[model samples]
Target: MQKTSYLKELVIKNTHEKNGANNSKKETEKIQSLLNLFSIANPNSGTGTSIDGDFGPATEKAVKNFQKIKNAAQTGVVNQNLFDLLALPIKKAFEDPIQGSNLRELIVNTAKNHLQNNPFELIIHQQGNSGPWVRSYMDGKEGSDWLWCMGFVQTIIDQASSIQGKNFKSLMPLTYSCDTVGVKGIEKHLLTRYQAARSNPSVIKPGDIFLIQKSNLDWMHTGIVIDVNGDTIETIEGNTNSMGSSNGNAVANKIRNFKTSKIDFFSIAPLV
Candidate 1:
């Protein structure tokens, strides 16, 4: 059978239904993964069920809600249609069918597109010069005067993940603080320290994040990696300029030398 078909069969076989037999731990885990992804995509669809591998009333409700959204039968069961909907975004995002092209490549492509388009526009605000794009980084929570470098990076990652029906918060912490991202990386064991990444530059690839360190425990600036070459790295940064600064006026493309720069690198964990 085709891989996708086989996978669908596996999910259906293992799924826990409202009135059906309880699913095995493994089966329930798979279902929970899909539920988590769905919740991230549709926050109000009752799909935000806890991913504890227990297909209880909440999971059933979430399934039913998702079914309604898809215009399918509200069976509250993991059926082929449900599986297909869960997988559609990823399949659509990577339809090019290139071998070994992973989600990171998709993220890099998205960031590159933003850089090429320069979607942000400078506007005078009560706080300072801001724009719609900058506000979007904060999900419209913070104003223009806010330090939004980390928000910009987080927004790009979140947007890219959304395109593939994945959750950015599941992959990385959704924070506006660069230091918070660095701390979360260390706590989650997802961090590649600056010195190590500099010594072994191969670890710094496109879609990775670079944090400009202000002190031993503080990061003042952030950016997304678009390309990495020997000794030099290309980045798309927010609130930066021709001469880079964490509090610069707008988003701009930048190049920095890893060996000579005081930057820490955080490698984003791959989506399951």
Candidate 2:
């Protein structure tokens, strides 16, 4: 597992790139890596900067191009302002204030906030599931082994619990395995199997968890239910995209039919 090092510091401290000032190799490397990351996400911004830990012409050019696209000054420099701009997505995801009247509302709101930030898995060092969002939800561990759908759900629950002074562990265990969550839900009398859920759609509610059941005892993916109407459930899930693959690249909002999809519901009534 690779430890995610995406802008580890909230604020860049004591570093200036340009005009031959305090451009330490370490800081320059961070700036270069961030430029590469930004370029990967925003194609028209610029090409990726080499992560050679040196503030070369390529890095400066990339910075200027990025500034051009963002409509900022094209000074080809990386000062505190540029660093903050680079770290904007992360700051928005982790530090934005959420509004909700209750715990379940809070959970849904948090998931939406994450979705708004457009969290996507970055391919770092040729490794999949590598990025700051994945690490934030997966306890700083990211890699091929970190299938983060469950991690994303648990993170939303944890955040809501923290804000409400409730214990999230009581509702869901801190594990990345959908199977573990399913089994624990069953043991806790919180799980409603697909058939049961379909027979009584009213049992499924927003803020509850929906697990994509693969077999009688195994689940493949999980997410937070944001809405339930008639026969379909709207969800905000991670590790999935518009195609709804169990293992995908980004966090997304999707709709799944409970009657057609083999999904189990885990009631959060115990916490509420």
Clash-forming residue pairs, model 1: none
Residue-level lDDT of model 2, residues 185-270, one tens digit each, is 89999999999999999899899999998999999999999999899999999999899999999999999999998999988898
Residue lDDT tens for model 1, 1-272: 00122223223454467556756655564565556555654678777665555777888888888888888888888855577676554333323222225667866776666554343324333444343345455555435557878877776676666666777887666677888988888887777877888789888878889998888788899999889989999999888878987777667888999889788888875662
- For candidate 2, the TM-score is 0.85
What TM-score against the true fold does each predicted structure earn?
A: 0.60, 0.85
| Candidate of highest lDDT | 2
C-alpha lDDT score of every prediction, in listed order: 0.67, 0.81
The runs of at least 3 residues in candidate 1 whose Cα sits more than 4 Å from the true structure, single-residue gaps closed, are: 1-100, 121-126, 142-144
lDDT, candidate 2, residue 22? 66
- What TM value does model 1 have? 0.60
